[model samples]
Target: MKMKKLLISIVILVLLGIASIYIPIPGYMVITPGEMLNTKEMIQVDQGTKSKGDYYITSFEQGPANAISYLFSFTGIIKVEPMPPLDEQKMDVEKGKADLENSKLSAMTAAIRKAGKDVKYEHKGWEVLKDDTKYGIKKGDLLQAIDGISLKSSEEFFLPDLIKYYEKKKVGDTVTYQILRGEETLEVKTKLVEQNGQKIDDLNLRLSVKQKAEFQSPVKVNFKKLDLGGPSAGLMMTLDILDELLPEDLTKGNKIAGTGTISADGKVGIIGGENYKVLSTIDTGVKVFFCPKENAKLAQETVKKYDIKVKVVPVATLDEAVEYLRNMK
Candidate 1:
């Protein structure tokens, strides 16, 4: 009887182990599809636009091999590009390279203070481009100050108040502002044109924050500071930045699973960690997988081999992602 009982116990243990293979552990979040970015996002400047004699700290290099540089930097990978010094022609051109819309709008209503014309203009915003500018605004000549208020950091201004007040006027309503340009300060007035036939609710206030970086050029990645420890965190970091800035609720409070690098223009770039990240997220029962377009292919193959049931989507930008999340509800 003792021998029979021991054999039965062994058989029961084997069966339990086999059953565990089919059962999935619970996960923490759900993922959905949006866009597919092709490369890892980093910051780089146009050498033609940049001239010698300006103070610049080489913020990032190019490619996965350069991850070490950021590990030792002051802001880690978060502030990859160092602040560059300003010269006359070079400063004007660099400022122009920022978001065109923001520059145009700001030039009309605000005047940035400076010690002199030689002072480098800089501002703190929620999302700054790599080359350093407000994410959505552009650069232009200033004519006046809006509502007698001076513009400081692009990110700190109150936008809703401006929009609400502007709405009361007709298309040709004249608005006056105190303006400064190239060592001269004067009053300038322009007619406000009513923008119609679009669903634009409010002026993108977040666009004025000028500290965001521009990722048009490739900067090197120093990966030691990343908690995820791979290129996958890049895209997620970009999304996190977007979620932090606008009130649109991009993530909708869901757990977002993605892989890519954050670019200065808010574009998602490609990176490694697809297979590993997929497996890790799968084991936790993740609802969605955000990865590169190329890596998504690998993930699909892995899914077929392992018989995965979860959803995996590739993305290219934060805008696409916001749309995807919005449709899920």
Candidate 2:
């Protein structure tokens, strides 16, 4: 009887250990936006579309352990709000091919350099209202200041942080702006409205000033929704842009997978979560996995250790991925 009881206790302990991985331990459940925010300027912007502004996204950090914590964190919460599909709703991903093509590193760097010298704010893009009347603001338009204060790149200006600081103010509270338009310095006044919606305040309104802005005048935009797990979508975002810029289709309907952070210039950078992503692709029977040059070398080394039937297409930039995809087609 004693031996049988000991075996039962051991099995229970093993089960508990497995369960603990998913259940957030006492210390790890709550994650703040600050934890995920990248303090540096390493982020993508959509310069070619009506929707513009500065935004960044962190990759979804999930595993058996994270998966459980995510579940528990949202256990009793109910969402009545309807959201757009992953590709459509999330500004983090590229909107379409045009956005990717327009967001090239050269273009962005040029904008930033000019803004640094002559303007207080500069970003490749900004969003327009539903009526398409005007953009949030244009590039090269001097953003004299936010909330009646002068701004310099020296001041890390983020919309969410501003709102949080000013949240105590009422709806009619005025956020004064001094704008520079061309050779003329203009003054514009905007009033604060009550915050609505279910998402965090920081994510809802992303504001920035710009010297000037350029966007495609709205050609026929074909959009297909995709399920992208993280920032790795940057590479795919650029390739999709090249496809629109070029004469041919890159994704000829075959399942393609890969991960990397891509610049508008096409340089692919290392992204997070390679191993789990590789495993996901393998399990999903993906045909081609495109990885950044750095990640590709590591992934290749890993693939050789395990028998992976999927073809791994290694690319250094968005152009390379586009070329590979075209060849596959």
Candidate 3:
């Protein structure tokens, strides 16, 4: 009887262990190391050159935490955080897609301009910068018109006209906005409010609406649609495009990987999850990693913490990145 009782206890423990693997912890997310992708295979430029070495982009995996992952979060192997609201998560997914599209365009424009080619841009529409308004205007909505006035004109004149229209109205005024949300077109009504002791004007409008850039360049650049989203790959994508445009190889025959958002004017912006990204580079044979200047300290710390062999280089602009590669031995 004693032996039978011991066997039953062992069976119960095994069942509980198995159940833990599938059980999910609510309101929590887990982040883990993701893959390193070669940018050469992801981006293609027509009539572009090739590089002897490869440029890679690193990413992190994040999702709802399982029971095991929730427990492992205490050990520092993974990260666990409160999951964002479902509505916020949906909006983030949309914004991530938009950011990725803008990143590709910025990468192409920056590379082409760097190659001494002409590139011009027009403001397509206004992108919603905030969703705090009560007019049903959510973040990521594209505002095409205000009070029946189209904001799609020349970038120089659009803001002036928009400001002029708003100047005629006082606080507590009602205005209609024509916006595009995915495949649906909706008109939203919002009340004008005073900002900084002044009625809402172009300056106030600019706070909530950012002009979307549409580039026209002589050189055509296209990216293979991947399951990836977000602007963190912008810097690496720009470098890869430049490598294909210039005669000299940017990689210097060494494997390079990086993360940072690139602007149309070549500025590099900070990105999140630098520590996890550093871990992703381990065992990947990446010789150097470039990140935004702001993230450099944290990235270096992570590298040191993990004892990674990769060098962390911080850059403020696309030009700085290019210059660094040019001077690499």
- TM-score, cand. 3 vs. native: 0.75
lDDT of 3 by residue, 1-329 (tens): 99999999999999999997877788888898788989888998899987989998988898988988877887665798888788667656766776677678778888888988889976677677777454566878887777888866533222434555766888778887778999898887767776434455322333344558767888888789867777799899999998899978888899999999886778887677888887899987899999988789989998988799999999988999888888888
How far residue 229's Cα lies from its native spot in candidate 1, in Å, is 3.7
Give lDDT tens digits, candidate 2, residues 122-197.
Answer: 3432332122113344544555556554543312122333535566666656666565556775555566654331
TM-score of each: 0.33, 0.41, 0.75
Q: What is candidate 3's CA lDDT for residue 229?
A: 76
Off by over 4 Å in 2: 1-23, 28-60, 63-213, 217-230, 241-247
Q: How accurate is candidate 3 locally (lDDT)?
A: 0.79
- lDDT tens per residue, model 1, 1-329: 99999999999999988766444333211122223221112212122121111110001122211233344333222222322233423543433343333322222111111001121334423332322142222343332346564443332232334555766656656665554444665554555653322112122211122333122212221112221122234444444333333345554445556565433333445554355455544444445667656557877675666566657777765456556766855
Clashing pairs in 3: none
Question: Where in model 1 is the C-alpha error above 4 Å?
Answer: 1-230
Top-lDDT structure, candidate number: 3
Q: What is the lDDT of residue 207 in candidate 3?
A: 32
Worst 10-residue lDDT window for candidate 3 reads 201-210
Worst 10 residues of 1 by lDDT: 51-60
Task: List per-prediction Cα lDDT, in the order shown.
Answer: 0.39, 0.44, 0.79
Top candidate, metric TM-score: 3
